[model samples]
Target: MKMLVNVILPIEPFNSMVRDGSVGEIIGRVIDDIKPESIYFSEQDGSRGAVMVVEVPDASAIPSIAEPWFLNFEAHCEFRIAMTPDDLKRANLSKLAEKWNGVHA
Candidate 1:
């Protein structure tokens, strides 16, 4: 499955890592291990944040990807299932709609 990983890091250790010049190296190491299909970096809620899309074989793979951020940066992380355009196109939405057409929210 494809999963989206969002990581939000606090300022203290993140800023400290930047000051010490280890930020890039640390983040790079983690990125290399995960080898995500896509990654974007930006600020979130006034904190350093990243969004990564990667292929996950199973739930067990999550710890390997998230542990780096947790142990190194004390980051707040989230994982969610993701779908590509093709995946959406291939979905059986018609059948799903028929199955729930009369269902209440």
Candidate 2:
């Protein structure tokens, strides 16, 4: 399945890394490892942040995806399942609605 990984990097260590010119190398290592389908960098809540869409094989894969950021940048990470339009179509929501509509509560 595809997962959206949101990473929030703390100011202190992130700034220190940038000042020392290690940011690019570290980020490159992470990018190489995760091999995200898509990635975007921006600020979130006044902190350095990144959003990456990656393929995750299973729940056990979460740590491998998240630990790099945590260990390198002391970052906070959140993961959410993501689906393409075709994946959503496969869900058969109309059938679910019909089944649930018959229930009182």
Candidate 3:
């Protein structure tokens, strides 16, 4: 499965790392470890953040994939299954809609 890992780092440690010039080295090491399919860095909700897409063989691998960011940057991390356009096209939307479209109402 492919997962999107969203990382948001707090300003304090993040600024410190930037000032010390360790930010790139830290992020680089994790990138080397994960070898993500895609990665993007940008601001999110007024915080420094990154979004990376990587393959996860199983649930247990989440810790290995996430721990580096947490340890290095004191980051708030979130992981979610990500879908490509082809995957979305293959979904059984009609059935899902029937199942839940009006259930809340």
Cα distance off (Å), candidate 1, residue 63 = 0.4
Candidate 2 per-residue lDDT over residues 19-94, each given as its tens digit: 9999999999999998999999999999999999999999999999999999999999999999999999999999
Identify the superior model by lDDT, candidate 1 or candidate 2. Answer: 2
Better of 1 and 3 by lDDT: 1
Could you say which candidate leads in lDDT? 2
Worst 10 residues of 2 by lDDT: 96-105
Root-mean-square deviation of Cα positions for candidate 3 versus the true structure, in angstroms: 2.1
Q: For every model in order, what is the number of clashing pairs?
A: 0, 0, 0
Off by over 4 Å in 3: 95-105
Tell me each candidate's TM-score.
Answer: 0.92, 0.95, 0.84
Please identify model 2 stretches exceeding 4 Å from their true place. Answer: 102-104
Off by over 4 Å in 1: none
Please give, for residues 2-103, the per-residue lDDT of candidate 1 as tens digits.
999999999989999999999999999999999999999999999889999999999999999999999999999999999989899789889899999999
Best by TM-score: 2
> What does candidate 3's lDDT look like per residue over 47-68, in tens digits?
9999999999999999998899
